[model samples]
Target chain A: MPRGQPPLSLPALIYEPKVRGIIFQVLLLAALVVAAWSLASNVAVNLQRQNIASGFGFLDRTAGFEISQQLIDFKPTDNYGRAFVVGLLNTLLVAGLGIVFATILGFTVGVARLSSNWIVSRLALAFVEVVRNMPPLLTLFLVYFAAIKTLPGPRQSIELPLSSFLNVRGLYMPKPQWLDGSSTIVVAFIAGIIASMLLARWARQRQVATGQQVPIFWPSLGLVLGLPLLAFMIAGQPVAFEYPALKGFNFSGGMVVQPEFIALLFGLTVYTAAFIAEIVRAGISGVPKGQKEAAAALGLSAGQSMRLVVLPQAMRIVIPPLTNQFLNLTKNSSLAVAIGYPDLVSVFAGTVLNNTNQAIECILITMGVYLVLSIVTSIGMNMFNARMALVER
Target chain B: MDAGIRNRRIAITTAALLAVAAGPAMAQTKTLDTVKARGTLNCGVNTGLAGFSMPDDKGQWTGLDVDLCRAVAAAVFKDATKVKYVPLTAKERFTALQSGEVDMLSRNTTWTMSRDTSAGLSFVGVNYFDGQGFMVKKSLGLKSAKELDGATICVQTGTTTELNVTDFFRANKLNYKPVVFEKLDETVAAYNSGRCDAFTSDHSQLYSERLKSPKPDDNVVLPDVISKEPLGPAVRQGDSGWGNVVRWAHFAMVNAEELGVTSKTVDEMQASANPEIRRLLGKEGDFGKGMGLDNDWAYQIVKQVGNYGEAFDRNVGAGSRLNIARGQNALWTKGGLQYGMPIR
Candidate 1:
């Protein structure tokens, strides 16, 4: 239409960037749709032809089997769906505890690696190097075998204080049975926590208002412990100990911490902590040296400067990678199958799929669960990261 | 018009590529034909179940189940060595056969009704007559499974043993905990390390597993046969031709044992005038032809892998360290239940 411009045509339109981009995008979408449809149809036809039942309907059937470690109530007569829930809970238990333990150990060892004491730094270095290098599965096996091999039998269980027993089967401890009115103590503990939070906030505000510091640690501890103790006394000390004793073959009447669970937690925590330690070290190192120097110039001690200046800043960098380590620990808990821990993969994917012969359905469900777990973990860590992030005016 | 033509051409090419990416429409080929074309029989067996399907020190598999696979191979290829052994766990065995990863599964798998009907597996026939039992430490001095009231039992997961132990404990009103493991080695190791008070499995497996303990005599199998466990070979269902071939492979061995057609006497007995022996050795009728095999299928099976009696004795019976008696596994003529169908 313009003086020197050629008339718009189909050939010319194809060469245009906007038109080319749309065409390529549409073509790519079409290819993906076709591939996905073909794969699904292929699976369906194969499953039908093979006559192997493929659906989630089998979850309703009676499981007719037993699980060793259950965090919730379970029986052999439970349905497959309930068994799956039991497995999921066990997996969550191990992963949740593992994350907590690994974080504590990781932060400690990471800071120790930078300690001025040579022995402390070298020990931390050796721990991180050795554990991070070996395979998680091998470490699990070693820990499991060590527990199984070294521990004594129930008849000759090693005696521990407070009437606990350690044996090959497990660590049998005295379970605290709470009578009525235990709720009073629980309520007091919660109130103490709330009061301590309020006190710390007030103390922080007072310090900002007037350059004076309040001793929050001892007072907070006193409130927490004293409230709980007073509640227990007022409630007539409503707690009884159920000590485990050998009855027939194993210890009866008390809580038993299974070796399988202990080994799984130990293995996953140690292995995951090694990688987490490196992340922490990198995070701490990423903080500017100027921050520490400024704190010292203000007459703050090394410990105070580290606690007040460096770690807070380092946390922003540490959290994202630390989230990855947590997710990894969760996934690696699947290795519990090797040592007979009744985790999700061991129970649901391994046993249920085999019994039902519904591989596609069982595996799909297991993958979906892990996907959701990872997403939830990512969201939580991201929220925490947001809080620690530097705010701009 | 030229641009439109180019777009059409690109669409057609994309469709063609998509079709290629989606694997070829899997035509249901007869398993026999596929195995023949592949030139080796893919047989799934246990990872390591001694006296049943474990490999020897020389890496040569030698057991009752291994012999069954060899018998099928001998019948098809005329050479017992033309077999690819795929070691599978108890959990992996059925899926391996169902997926057609293996043409035949000769693992010591129990032939349950559910496996036969819904799981899409055709268990050919029982190769080992087994029953669930428990093995406990002799120091525990447990005489019978009844004494295992409050015990913790170690069992391999994905097995009928898990169910049987539960039922046994529940029926007897005994409280027990089950420590289940994925692999047989793990279960046995847990049992040996005193992690469990008892290890329960098929009776034959109990004897075999006891040998794995550091001191075999320190433990003993309790006098308990809780549930019927007829361990056998299985193949994918819906292939009647393939099913018949595997079925008769086992039947041929049993019939040979019944008719006294030992591997040593198979050749000489073929010349004997006994009609039963003649028909069995494939001299009278073309029984193998019905199953798409040579007429001398039974002869080859006998010559290569020996009869059922020899296999039992050599693997799990008195000749082996397991020393399991032929109790209910004996031929029907000898007051046992192993009755083979007539070849004719």
Candidate 2:
């Protein structure tokens, strides 16, 4: 390599591309640090000047407030930290159920939208257009008012099957009371699930090994269904149903599900399913036309061709967009504050933040929670996406 | 490479230190000066509560709480119409005041220990002496809150009413479930639709909410007062100058009522020979100078916004639809709790 005749001077070094890039990057980072520091200090000094309390110390203080829906055991005497956990669990419960229901409904509607039947496609198209056009909050308001308005009062509640009562207050059904031997039945149910999974893997391997296929559906179903029944019988029928009994003001001694929960869950699921349906339709259509033809030529029925050949490829496209819908539904669950569902944002952020008056701390913690939840969801979806991705070979 | 990294670290540390040192300096602006510069008082009121702080078709806010804001504005600007009413929810009131988004909060906020101390607010004085009560269907045949056992009660959250209901139920050894809401309208609607066995709130609010229902005559407010709710205006803490201005504005109104000075009679009362009336009407002393306001501050309030009795009558008393009787809210001489601090 050719060497320079003389060493570069200070001005030349500054003008050098490598040296200039490093200097500018350092300057940018320093500016960002200063900006962040000033913002934090401004909040701190403002809070201090106003004599408003700061910090997470208020988490241990007694909440002194009651929540309507609590997933875990909580009372007014419980501390703020427990209240937060209860609210988080409630949010997770709704979002988890919302995701499962929305996915199923979305996939069905998506397939219906592509169906040859004129009525089916038109109905699916109408549902997607109508629901997706309105705001989720408006939908929530509509659902909540409809539920409250149409249902009968407690005195004139509609009696459902299994001794359940449907009223404006809530839907009250019989709660299952676990006896001493209930744990044995639970263990048996879990074991049955594990056994069915193993049997399915064995059947798949047998099909791959030989041209002949062994029927695994009935055997797997029997194991999953029969084992739990046998355990229940052996345990002397350890669970009993506690029917709801009408008392002075309302029903007593039963599992009472609040209308707020129903409305919120229904609104979120219905609204999000509209978007998911579109995503699913796009995914199914993205598959090559040749794949279906190939499956059809192999003597596969239309359902078999779509399910076995088209859907597997469509999943890779569906998973990423589906992740976004899941995240949106989770965040939108905070609208529970409007309807009094006692989700995390409703109970913890709204009530706890007001009670403690630690706005910065409470808001930061709440934002952090959503951030972590979204990140975890993304990581899980990415892992599943990687598995469904095309093989390089 | 090490030298470059070391230089960058030094630069970042120095900048951070300087930035932090500037924070307290930036926080030292006086609220009074800011409000004066803005030429209008940013007063926080309820989003919409009948007879307390509701707006009409033209967006003119009118209520007992809205009058308090006008009184403060009249004292400061000598024009009662110079207030910018910021409607806030129960959950957003304190934060709005503490953040300086509103100069003062005239919302129907309860004067609690935590709010006055840690929430960075100072209560001027009680403008409304209310108590938590239950409103149920008239056909229920329930006489008292004690009969509300096994009842589902709907209540608004982020208020003293939430804690009060829990305490009341626990003290009475009764079983009840609370369905807490964020807004007053939602709570009222839920109760109206039979989603709750009873709706609990400040007695004044229950009356106000009852009027908004489909059939106001169908619901009856129970006589049981579960808790004391001294609703009043509040200003941010640490700004004694601004705090004194709002506090004296409220006091001037109460004092005017005690001295028999209504808005119609305020001009004649200014010419009275009574020394106490003269001092209150800005004829004898410069009382407003101590609070960084005009000498005619109290006069402006009395002349433009009327005295406390007039405001109460016009907003929530017999003159309005609510027609709430002055129970504990009457003047101290009439066996009530609203005694003004001596102007002297």
> Candidate 1 chain B, which ten residues in sequence have the lowest lDDT sum?
B1-10
TM-score of chain A of each: 0.95, 0.96
Off by over 4 Å in 2: A1-23, B1-27
Model 1 lDDT on a 0 to 1 scale: 0.88
How many pairs collide in each candidate, listed in order? Answer: 0, 0
Look at candidate 1 and tell me the lDDT of residue B135: 94
TM-score of each: 0.94, 0.95
- Residues A1-393 of candidate 2: C-alpha lDDT, one tens digit per residue: 568754678888898899999999999999999888877777677666767777888999998777878778898899999999998999999999999999999999999999999999999999999999988888998999899999998889999999999999899999999999999888988998999899888888888898667878898889888998999999999999999988998999889899999999999999999999999999999999999999999999999988999999999899999999999999989888878799998888778888887766776777888899899999999999999999998
| Candidate-wise lDDT, in order | 0.88, 0.87
Model 2 whole-model lDDT (C-alpha atoms): 0.87
